[model samples]
Target: MLKAKVGGALPAANEAMMQRAEAAIGDLRQNFKAWLEEEVGKLEALMRTARTSGIEGEAGEALFTCAHDLRGLGSTYEFPIITRIAASLSKLIETPEQRAAAPVALVDAHVGAIRAAILQNVRNDTDPIGKALAEELETRVTKLVGERS
Candidate 1:
């Protein structure tokens, strides 16, 4: 019986298989971008509803869920800034207690920031505008939560 060497180069067949898999996934990034944009639109609509209805009960929960989903996907889709902004929004409305008291102005700030970030195509944390926006959101969240506490 022939034994394969450990920690050695991959077998030629295995290497070929890996290459084929990579090729198959070549369009994955493009598809992800399209899907991410669609999801962002849905999130925006949820934000609108939350804004009009006030972020409480079902509306608040929906907004939080959308923000959580976007937060999770942003980094994977090469939008680290989105991840940061979404994280802020998610944190702001994390609990039912928090959601009940969540200010519409604060929620609007967060949602508007997210929409601006996406519409302006801010992908990285290095962008000055993205950085500023993130900081502003963080400050607003801190101030509002502090006032409530």
Candidate 2:
């Protein structure tokens, strides 16, 4: 008697599923720009709060959360450059202790870069300008906090 594989579907089935998934993603892509803009607005508002309340208490924690969210969502929004920059920002203030020590200017710069990346349609590191800005921000963050452990 013949037996099927225990753990997976046939290649043809997998390919069909992948095609469907791609179509779904294509449909979602139409909304990605608006979604990305909304997320950036949230980040900006959080940054404003951080400006007044400082980066140690609720405002700082919220800022980090927003940055973390943006880092995760950036590529989904077709803006991998935002992901890189937001990742840097998230690393700079992931913990309360780090937030307390984090420089306001660095935080603001990261936010600004993410905003600019979206506004300028710099979607990924392929753009030399976006790549350079992301790398510079990452370098500064590493200098202050070292690499992620």
Candidate 3:
């Protein structure tokens, strides 16, 4: 009984293609995570500065848009940390009372905690895009805080 031995399970070429596809998907995930982390850093810094000095003019508008964008992205990606942080931020400005009472120190501490969580607990498939972005945002945040003060 000449059982034509065709290769196991997947044909070699098909297996190779599938492997490539998986690798491509992995690459895509890495890129997306990198992008999201950069975005988060930017949002955190903006929040920090706005909280510290009180946002104003075009910057205030930009900050609000940034918060809104982060919430939408966070919701889409199912990043619980991002979603919660963004929700807290949005609530701070949701109503007049909330906005008037929200404290700069509170926002800074909460966001600082979240940033640490992301840096320590969250693992992105890519390299340290988050690290680079965090550093850049850190510098900008310091400068903004100083300016506001």
Candidate 4:
């Protein structure tokens, strides 16, 4: 038998596995991004209604309902960030005091965190919920505190 080349097969196999993994990640990122953009549009509309129609009003309720529906959809996709924010914003939508202004900043913070997660590929598997949204709420609360000072 001719001498076999021992190392020759390993590189090709490793490359193929890496390619498969990258492709899978790419698919998740692309699909998740598309879904997130759509969800963001919905969230923006909800916020606008909460601001304009009055979060306590019937219009705000309708918008909140839409947001809740979106949250449910996100849950189906395991998009915990969207789901958590939608839930938190539901309470804010229902409240609609001048205090509701707080969640506006909260929404902004969530947007920033989402952008970061996308860029860094940081998976929130430990909590599986609400870390980004909580950060957002804290940011909003802090902003409100700053405004008062």
What is the C-alpha lDDT profile of model 2 across 1-149, one tens digit per residue? 12354555434557778899989999999899899999999999999989988999999999999999999999998899999999999999999999988999999999999999978999999999999999999999999999777
Q: Is candidate 1 or candidate 3 better by TM-score?
A: 1
RMSD of 2: 3.4
Instruction: Give per-model TM-scores.
Output: 0.77, 0.90, 0.51, 0.46
Which stretches of candidate 1 lie above 4 Å from their native place?
1-26, 146-149
lDDT values, one for every candidate: 0.81, 0.92, 0.55, 0.55
Q: After superposition, how far is residue 30 of candidate 4 from its true place, in Å?
A: 7.5
Give the winner by TM-score: 1 or 4.
1
lDDT of 1 by residue, 1-149 (tens): 13444656555677788888877766577887787788788888988887778777788898899899999988877788888988888888988888887777887887788778778888877989889989988888877565333
Worst 10 contiguous positions by lDDT, candidate 4: 1-10
TM-score of 3: 0.51
Clashing pairs in 4: none
Ranking by TM-score: 2, 1, 3, 4
Among all windows of 10 consecutive residues in model 1, the one with the lowest summed lDDT is 1-10
Kindly report which residue pairs in candidate 1 clash with one another.
none
**Candidates 3 and 4 compared by TM-score, better number:** 3
| Order of candidate numbers by lDDT, starting with the best | 2, 1, 3, 4
Candidate 3: segments with Cα more than 4 A from true spot: 1-27, 56-58, 95-97, 122-149
Error of 1 at 102 (Å): 1.7
Q: For model 4, state the Cα shift of residue 70 in Å.
A: 2.5
